[model samples]
Target: MKKYKYPSVLTIAGFDGSGGAGIQADIKTTSALGCFSTSVLTALPVQNTRGVRKIYPIPIEAVADQIRAILEDIVPDAIKIGMVHTPQLVETIVSTLSGYKKIPVVFDPVMVATSGHRLIEEETIKAITEKLFPIADVITPNMDEAAILADMKVVSLDDLYTAGKKIKQLGCKNILLKGGHQETPIITSLFYDEDGHYHSFESSKLNTNNTHGSGCTLSSAIAAYIAQGKTLYDAVSLGQQYIYQAIENGMDVQTGSGNGPLNHFFNPQKLIKNEMV
Candidate 1:
């Protein structure tokens, strides 16, 4: 009898040695959400809670090989992309994943780190906007990233709406404009669908500094839920809830000297079994 496998998500991103963000966070979030996780490392960034020291981008060929090796065997049900630090890397990834258009892709435009370090070059940003954005099922960009992509400030809700619209014009089918950077009592994460409809997700802002991997975690959680057969709206909604709980659960726990990580396993679950087994 053929053994059934769990729903899986492939995360292509940088490697954060601190385990708070990047590939580590993606894997943790996907697993916590009950999906098998795979990864292709784009860059090896010497980073921690304090900040990013240096980034060693994996050779474009090596990056391509890693992705190809995984897709040829354990093709993921969904894909989550983050942190391509160069135009060459962006082009390589976009070209490689072009054949897998049917796979749902949740892309996090990780141009800058939480510690204010620029993780990507300007040319790389252009490559992502021109190539990856169009193919991605959805792109998750925070206020700062949105501003850079849309070429406008994203401090106000109106600004967020404008930025979301502008980014959508860049060719992405859907947009999730994260509102954590807004100085408001509530955090509002807006979801813009392909049909130009908007779904607003608002939650009470939890005051905490341990938000290092929040963006990466949320995007991966969204991918996991999508792989589990949830609708885009439901996936985003539930992913937000999961991230909120993770943040609330770890609000007090100290993990590092600077910004810390969320408790990814705050509510853990076993790998979903195949019912026919």
Candidate 2:
């Protein structure tokens, strides 16, 4: 008899040679959450903890090939998407992922980097809005990204809800509007559901420069929990808690001269329990 394999999650994102964000961080977070992770690199970036130097987007056909290979052998329990450089790439991803409606898809709208660089082209944003937004199970966008989606400034919590509602019009079933830009003592995140209800998760903002992968980590955690049969609300809540704790744990670790990566392995819970225990 064969033993059961752990749930597998697929991350479609960029590659960070610094290993602090993108595919590297997604793999770390998913593995820490006790899920197997497979990734398809979207962009190869010349970056460090400080900032991005250059980005090279992969050909669309290569991206499709990677996705096809993964789905053929190991059907993913969940999928997390990030950083597609062009409208064409976004179209390709949506076309490929549309058939996988059985699995949850967590889309993170990564517009700007922590160092204030634009990650996606203007035309690609239009593509994401028109082609992919309607199909995502949940779309996670920070205040800045939310503002871009809403075509207005999201200056306060009230604005976040407005932005979320407007984003839902673009077609996501749910929206997780992140409040990391609010500059408050507490970091607040809002989850707006399809039925017009909203939920909030708040935690004390840790003072640190080690937040390179917080959004990717949170979105992937949500995917992992959903793969394990948790509801969207529960997944987002628990995912936020996991990220907050990881950020707190790694607040002091100086990974590079600039920002650092979160501590993905600070406390990992294994899926298989020891019989002796």
Which one wins on TM-score?
A: 1
* Cand. 1 Cα-lDDT: 0.90
- Quantify all predictions' global Cα lDDT against the true fold: 0.90, 0.86
Can you tell me which runs of candidate 1 are displaced by over 4 Å? Answer: 275-277
In candidate 1 the C-alpha lDDT for residue 127 amounts to 88
Could you tally the backbone clashes for each prediction? Answer: 0, 0
lDDT of 2 by residue, 222-247 (tens): 99888777888999999988998999
Question: Model 2 off-target regions past 4 Å?
Answer: 99-101, 271-277
How far does residue 216 in candidate 2 sit from its true spot (Å)?
Answer: 0.7
TM-score, one value per model: 0.97, 0.95
The top-ranked prediction according to lDDT is 1
